[model samples]
Target: MRTRRLIIGVIIALIVIIGAGFAFGALHKTKTNAKTVTLGIMPGGKQEDAIWKVVKANAKKSYGIDLQFVNFTDGDQPNKALASHDIDLNAFQHYAYLKSWNQSNHGDLVAIGDTIITPIHLYSTQYKSVDALPDGATIAIPNDLTNESRALHVLKNAGLITLNSSQGLQATVKDVKSNPKHLVIKEVDASQGPRTLPSVAAAVINYNFAQSAKIPASDSIFVEPFNADSHQWVNIIVANKKDRNKQIYKDIVSAYNSENVKATIEKEYPDGGEKAAWDLKF
Candidate 1:
């Protein structure tokens, strides 16, 4: 009977050990098989959307990632969704817009990869060039805070206006100390910038919006120069601050900055409407 009791005890110990090992293996497999990543995007451009379709297919084939997208029409929804963890990532905003969103929402989102610069341009139907506009002519610009300053800076750079130094990146039309042409600065929604053209003497338009409206590159009198002042305009892939260093996130960045993606950008925008910014130091 004593020998039988000792044998029973040994069997019970073995069973418990085996069960523990199997449980750990299951957990490891669960983590290894985790693949689905949902991303949020602002749906505006047909070409841009097609480009993302390519990324989705490549990510699945190359890394076994189940990349999914959540499209948002409103400009403000993506970051809010990301902050709530409703989506794992986003690639719609430039650094300046991201900074503005963070400040307004008190959120801690972070940029994981540099993508491209979809530059702002001053477009006109009536005026041939910057110098061609008559004095006191109406000009349109984006009304949003950061872009208002950016659009104004574009005009300043083109020698149409002089903004006071005090306003920094938050300048408005009121901050224009010198409008040499006495140009009436019209404030409109960023998306509406292109539509105001030919009505106003000119409008400063974002590249994606301009593309959607079928505005030709020849219509632009001034393209934002690729320099230190436009550093914040470089677009980026963003994630929640806590997920900044995740391996999967880094993998996405690598795929986006690949030669294949670079080739696609060059093919799509041969007119130089957008510039690949991953290799750029700034």
Candidate 2:
């Protein structure tokens, strides 16, 4: 009887240990397989759509991370979504735009990685070159402060007009100190730039919008210089300052700046539309 009782107690002890081991294994698996991360992106170009597909696959294969992309139509929504915690990350807007946004909204967004530099271009259907534009020609520029200043700089660089040096990146048409050709500057919504080309002699259009309108880079009368000096305009991957250093966010940045994605950007945007900012350090 004593032997039988000891055998029964040993069997019960073994069963409990086995059950506990299975429970721990299940819990560990649950912890490892969390929900996919959602990223916000501006909707427009095929390049962005293609890049997101590659990122999703690479993230899953390389780091066991699943990624989902949510497209925001306008410039304002992406930052707003990120700030409200509606999205995990956003890959749009340059450093200047981000700085302006932070200043206006009191937001704490920070760039974790550099993505690309989409050169803002002066496009025209009627004029072939900046010098070809006639006197009193109406030139359309983005109405937004950041892009208006950038357009003015491009005009100044192209020798079409001059801006007040002190006005800097905050420059508007009012800041234009001189117009050599007496060029009539029209401030329109950035999206309207390409559309206004038929009405105006020329328009300064952001690259993404130009690409969306199927405007060839060769058609640009003037293109912004892609160099260290223009680094402020390089688009970036952004997150809330508090979450900037998270390991998962770093993994996403790594996937974006991966060699494969870089290759894709090189092949797709070979023209002056958008160049990958691979050399930029975060």
Task: Name the candidate that leads on TM-score.
Answer: 2
Residue pairs that clash (backbone atoms under 3 angstroms), model 2:
none
1-282: candidate 2 lDDT, tens digit per residue:
999999999999999999999999999998878757789988746776787778788888887888888988888999999999999999878899999999999999999998888788899888889889999999999998888888888888788887787866678889889987999999999998888888999999987688778977667888877654367899899999999989998898888888888778777767846677867542
Q: List the residue pairs that clash in candidate 1.
A: none
* Candidate 1 residue 103 C-alpha distance from true site, Å: 1.4
Score every model by TM-score: 0.81, 0.84
| Candidate 1 positional error at 57, Å | 4.0
Prediction RMSDs, each to the true structure: 4.8, 3.0
Q: For candidate 2, what is the lDDT? A: 0.85
Best by lDDT: 1
For 1-282, candidate 1 gives per-residue lDDT tens digits of 999999999999999999999999999998998798888988747667767777787777777788888999988999999999999999899998999889888999999999889778999999789999999999999998887899998999899998898977668888999987989999999998877896999999888789879999889999888777787899899999999999888888777787778788888778887788898764
